[model samples]
Target: MQFTSGYGAEPGAWRLPGANLRSYTDMDQFVRYAQAAERGKIQLLFFADTPVLDVDLERQVPHFAIDPLLVMTSIARETERIGLVSTASTTFNEPYSLARQFKALDVISHGRAGWNAVTTSDPAAAANFGRAVPPRAEKYERAHEVLQIVQALWGSWEKDAWVLDVDGKRFADMDRIQPVDLQGRHVASRGPLPIPPSEQGQPVIFQAGGGGYGLELAGRYADGVYANPYTIEDGQAQRQALRDAAERAGRDPDEVKMFAGFMPAIAGSRRAALDRRRFLDESVDLRQRVRYLGAMIGLPLGYRQIDEPLTADQLADAVPSPHDPRSARALEVAREGWTLRDVLAHGVIDYHPVVAGTATDVADHMQQWFEAGACDGFSLAIDGYHDGVDAFVDQVVPLLQERGLFHLDYEGPTLRDHLHAREQYGLDPRVTETAAR
Candidate 1:
């Protein structure tokens, strides 16, 4: 599950009753949240990031307050079993340093760390990095090279590279260590990585993207793929697309796991859940929603006629901005012939599937999607105060476990153990062999 700080992508979540306004900065609170996830045996706790103040300063609460790596480092000390996935942009960071940092984290967390590689889209982030944003094609090309270099560096040291001999006065088998003398068009790195492999090998690689380049990167390298599938059909199509991409790249399709983003306004009862969703929707300003709709449709939508449904032609022609890839979900909702108000209330702008129901209802939705081959798993977005996290862990998780859809306890200690359980169950022969190696 992914939650950096505060409610994920919800502008009005901080203002909810009993919400923690200080969640963005509280280290103790983050530890508590991580522990809650560990209790439910969640495979990964993902942290999304950008190196800029991306949130709206006037209205929205600050989300990415602390660096993700730092927060994960703290949580690493607090939790033992749950995996820590920290976001690092290929756009801003150099490959050698990024690889070394995550390798160190993997060591610290005892193979329970994951690197969420991202090509940042926020234009403002370029100013912080002291460069102009590269063109989309150029950015993706660089990202590909960066990932390649990082992976090569991670594998530079062989499993038996460290001899640790004192009497022989040799600490490492120099012959076993190979230098990654990569001279790629976008980035280059030299020499074998200094750190030895952790118990789970290197940190697991994760990638999130909607475009072709992004999908290709995930298929080629990512062990886990973070995705935004707005509906069941979208999820199935994305899952098949990723599997196709993996096969085209000469990989086992089952090795690449898809994790769809999910944010639900859950309550004890179905009626209460709907009421909670309504309250959350009403908290946001109408003008902001109008702006969101206009951005999604790539047109100037007037708030005066917010109740009127957009014309079919307008919805059909709507092409999302390359930077704002999530706009497609809003366009999808618009294609359903819903009015601007209804689309806004549905919160399609965040580009995640939303559910509002009791624990049983939530479990049913998840089970249906899983059984239908919609996605491998869900990357839950917890509420700001952690109420959602507690509720899901305390309620929905047990129900799923009872149905034999979820694990009653963690199968093993390392993140790879948690992730590779499906492979061990015979999802793919090569993947099982690779995990064993």
Candidate 2:
């Protein structure tokens, strides 16, 4: 799931005819999306979060308005099997608090919770905490230390710590519970988490971010990786890199699943899908499109003609803005000689690859990537919210299931069971089900 709101991955999604603008704050909207994904036996519904109001709300609808964990909690009650994952920044939050919250969520969901650890780069989020944004190196370093503390906290309480001895009149075992006392360069914690492990043990750890320090953190701790790769080849290389990193950290490489982010625009036919993409592309007003294009290339383009070709010098001068790290992808498209209009039409502002096609077409693309070692699966986003999820679940999922590439039903009750679904796809020879640590 891209979001639990009306506005999806498409920037102009809210402007579509009959779009529900009120769904952003409505709890029922999230329940609908979660139930729909559950019907398809989708492994998980992921929600991305930013603590600050980062977008220009006057122009674009803010997607990260509500707390994702709170929303996921509501969804967790409404749905039975689908996994619920939410982003929580390691940079700004305390390790013990986040660890406790996620553990409680896991217990509440009966082991269907996942936490996406991120080193948030948004400077506005830093301002909310009355601190300047830390440098890239420092942020990742802190993230490493924080994750260590959180993991230790999660494991503090032994499986049998909460004992109920009716005959003996003793209800607990103090010796079984241990305190975590770890001191790192950036953070330290001393505690035994009050919450014990849930049915599947601790919540699955997912790491989001891509280069150097990010890979190291994921390799050491994450059971899954959330990634954005613009091309299949890039995805394949990233998978190999993650696997290598895991192996270097003395963990099983295959245990670290990479879910590359992809947004698909699906319809009954290929031409219709393309037309839907076009409709979404033209939904935004020209001025807003110009602003978006300018933001993508880090330039002021309100004065420039929309159809005019950007010069080589202009493309060369383009650099990533402080807030938007995806600007480079747009510049890459512009350097290929696309006009400003063409760039926006191609949706270059988003770093995730988009597929506009029929159900079969989408299924074929996913199958090819999986077979080619590009990714274990995708972190799917939609062209629209409710309709987009229904279209894929109704249309594309059956095709994948028919081809034996996906599970027809969930193999187990926990999120880890769904992820490590044994004997389902047979894509990896080493695939196995192991309890979460």
- lDDT string for model 1 (1-437, tens) is 77766554466667778776777888888888889888888888988888988767687666674788888988999899999998899988999999899988988999888888989877899889888788888888898778878877888888888999999999999887889798878889996789888878788888888789888877777789988887788889999999998876768788889998887667887567755655666656788778767876688888876777888667667787656656767787777776777666555665577666788888998999998899999988754445878888989899999999999888788888888822211023343244345
Q: What lDDT is reached at residue 417 by model 2?
A: 91
Q: After superposition, how far is residue 343 of candidate 2 from its true place, in Å?
A: 7.1
TM-score of 1: 0.83
Best by TM-score: 2
Cα lDDT tens digits for candidate 2, 1-437: 65735567776777767767777888888788779989999999888888888777777777673888888898888998999888999999999899899989999999899889999888889899888889999999898778878877887887877888999887878797788888888788898888877877888888888789999888877888998876678889999999998877766788889998887888877567756766777646767877877876677777366778787667667775656545666677677776676666556665687667788888888898888989999999887875888888999899999999999899899988988821211012121111122
lDDT of 2 at 145: 76
* Sliding window of 10 residues with minimal summed lDDT for model 2: 424-433
What do the candidate models score in CA lDDT, each in turn? 0.79, 0.79
